[model samples]
Target: MSTPFDLAATDELLSTTRAVRKRLDLERPVDVEVLLECIDLAQQAPTGGNRQGWRFVVVTDAEQRQLIADTYRRVSQSYFASRAATPTDDQTGRVRSSSDYLRDNLERVPAMVIPCQQGRPESLPLAAMASYFGSIIPATWSMMLALRARGLGSVYTTLHLVDDGEQVVAEALGIPDGWTQTALIPVAYTIGTDFKPAKRPPVTQIVGVDGW
Candidate 1:
C-alpha cells in the first residue's frame, strides 16, 4: 500500500523532537495563539477508550511563572544535587549540567504548560489507574511534537509534583478541585532548529521478539 505522507519528513520530525532545555530561547515571548494551535493539533492524538480527559494550563504571567519555577526548584535542587553527587558517564553528566541550567532559568522561559487529568489516580484500581493516565500522556507528547514542528522547544518536568509542590502550583494557578497535575512543560522558541537524533542502545538490546 502506498502512503500519502512524506516518510522522510515524518521520520525526521519524529526523531528530532527532543526534550529541549538549555537551548530554549529565554528572551523571546511565545505567542499564546501559537500554543493554542499546537494544542488543537495535540487534541487529535488517540486516548484510551476515547475518554479524552486531558487539560492544559498555560502560564504566561511573569509572577505566576516565577511561582511555578520556585516550586519546581524547591524540589529539583535536591534531585539534581543527589545526581551530581553520584558518578556518571559523560552523557549522563552532560544531562545533569543541562538540567541544572534549566532549573536555574525555568522562570525566564516564556511559557509554562501544565498538563492535567480529570481525577486523582493514586488509590484507584489497576485498570482505572492505567486508563486515566493513559488518556493524557499521549496528548502531551503530541503537544510536544506539534511545538517542535513550529520551531518551539519544551522540556517535560515532573520534579514539582513531589510532596506538596503540586498543591502549591495548583493554588498558584487557581486550578480547581479534583484535577490531577501530570507534568510541567517549559516552552519557548528554540535558539535554532538544528536538533539531531539522540544516541540510544540498539533495538536488539532493548527489545524482545514477542516476549521479554
Candidate 2:
C-alpha cells in the first residue's frame, strides 16, 4: 500500500537531527513562539498511562541562564578531568570536543530547556521508574526533532544532575517541589542545517531475526 506522507523528507528529518553543540549559533535569538510551537508538537507524543506529565521550563533570561550554566560548569570539572584520561575512538573524540566547547560557552547560549516529569523516578520501584520517565523522554526527543525541522539545534545534557545540581537548578528556577527534571537541553538556531546522518555499524551486526 502507498503512504500519503513524504517518506524521504520524514527520513531526512529523523536522520539528520544531530546532537548539535559547537555549530549552535549562540548569538541568534530563538523566538518564544517557535519554541512553544515545537513543544505543542511534542505534547502529542504518547505518555505512560496518559498522565501527560511533561513540563518544560524555558530559560532565556540572562541571569538565570548564567546561573544554570554555572551549575553545569561546577558539576563538569571532575567529569572532564576523568574523561580526559580515558581513551576515545573517533566518534567519542568528536563528541568530547563538542562537549568541551559547549561547557565553556553554555552561558552564552540563548535558551536552556529543562524538561520535567510529574514525579521523582529515584523513589519509584524499578517498573514504575521506567514508566515515570518513559512518559517524557519521547516528547523530549520529539521536541528536538521539531527544533531541527525549524532550523534550530539542541543537545541533551544530564551532566548537571551528577552532584545535587538538579536541586540547585530547580531552586534557581523556582520549579515546584514534586516535579523532577529529566534533562537540560541547550537550544539555539544552528549556524547551518546541513547535518548529515551519523555513521553507525551495520544493522546485521546488532539486529537479531526472531530472537537473539
Could you tell me every candidate's TM-score relative to the true structure? 0.96, 0.97
What is the C-alpha lDDT profile of model 1 across 1-212, one tens digit per residue? 59999998889999999889989999999999999999999899888788787789999999999998898899666777677789889888778888888889888999989999888888999998888878888889999999999999998889999888999999988888899999999999999999999898898999989999
**Per-residue C-alpha lDDT of model 2 across residues 46-109, encoded as one tens digit per residue:** 9988999878999999999999889999987899999999999999999999999999999999
Top TM-score model:
2
Output the lDDT of residue 152, model 1.
98
lDDT of 1: 0.90
Whole-structure CA lDDT of model 2: 0.92
Candidate lDDT scores, in order, read 0.90, 0.92
Per-model clash counts, in order, read 0, 0
Give the clashing pairs for model 1.
none
On the 0 to 100 scale, the lDDT of residue 101 in model 1 is: 87
